[model samples]
Target: MNTRILKSCLLGAMLVLGGCASGLTGETYSRDEARAPQTVRMGTVESVRLVQIEGTKTNIGTGAGAVVGGVAGSSIGGGRGSIITGVLGAVAGGMAGAAAEEGITRNQGIEITVREDGGQTRAYVQEVDPNMSFAPGERVRVLTVNGTSRVSK
Candidate 1:
């Protein structure tokens, strides 16, 4: 097959094997954690963006399905049948792959909370607009000169 396809397969395999674990925990934090007081603006998630996302899976299924479909379709007839079979196989394979991937990933909703300069907290039901942005909490960075500040997340 093509070298690109081989590389993609290898890369996908590696990514699939490497699990994702980065997420926030519900554990509460105290003001002492920051050490200093911080002033900032913030927004709350009035609602979660509940998207019925499919999980991610390997592309092997799609490739296999396409190959099988093409072979079966081609075998059914001779010249025209072969072409039709190949096309059908490719489409079927793609759909199968996507579905499989979605099942594996089981992607779900996201609650985006943004903070602004003011203390006023606004709750949005929909996904936050990229331009109309808010900070998650007060931006309290640890610096050699500035030091740390208390910020709520």
Candidate 2:
């Protein structure tokens, strides 16, 4: 049997196994649970907009993919052919890994427009959590403590 299929399998396996984790807790700060003065603004939701939130990008995916692809590609041929295949495989694997990582690490956010009780309007783009949601005219509290803000019902 030719090594093409084997190489493909190896590359696929590497991509699946060698990936990085991006921790997005949606909280601006951590470790300090100490009580801080929070500016609570009671408001009603005027609008809710769906948005895309960028998490992060580390070289782990691309780097791991390239290494595995190069090794897999090298096994299929010899001398110059092997080298060329290795380079090609590395490029493909790296690209795939990066795309996969980006897809996996993506976060969902919502742009919430609220009209305060004092006749002022504010918009907050916050990470979407399954436990939290808002609708038009729903009474909610806007909490901002130490520059970090969140809307809670």
Highest lDDT against the true fold, candidate? 2
Per-residue alpha-carbon lDDT of candidate 2 for residues 64-113, written as tens digits (9 for 90 to 100): 66766777777768999999999998998788766766776677888889
Candidate 1 C-alpha lDDT tens digits along 1-153: 434553565456335533531211122233453454443433343323434434445665565545545544555566887788768866875666556545655544334433334554433222223333324443422111133221234
Kindly report which residue stretches of model 1 are placed more than 4 angstroms away from their true locations once superposed: 1-65, 71-83, 112-117, 120-153
Can you give the lDDT of residue 40 in candidate 1? 40
Clashing pairs in 2: none
Error (Å) of candidate 2 at residue 15 is: 10
The clash number for model 1 is: 14
Model 1, global lDDT: 0.43
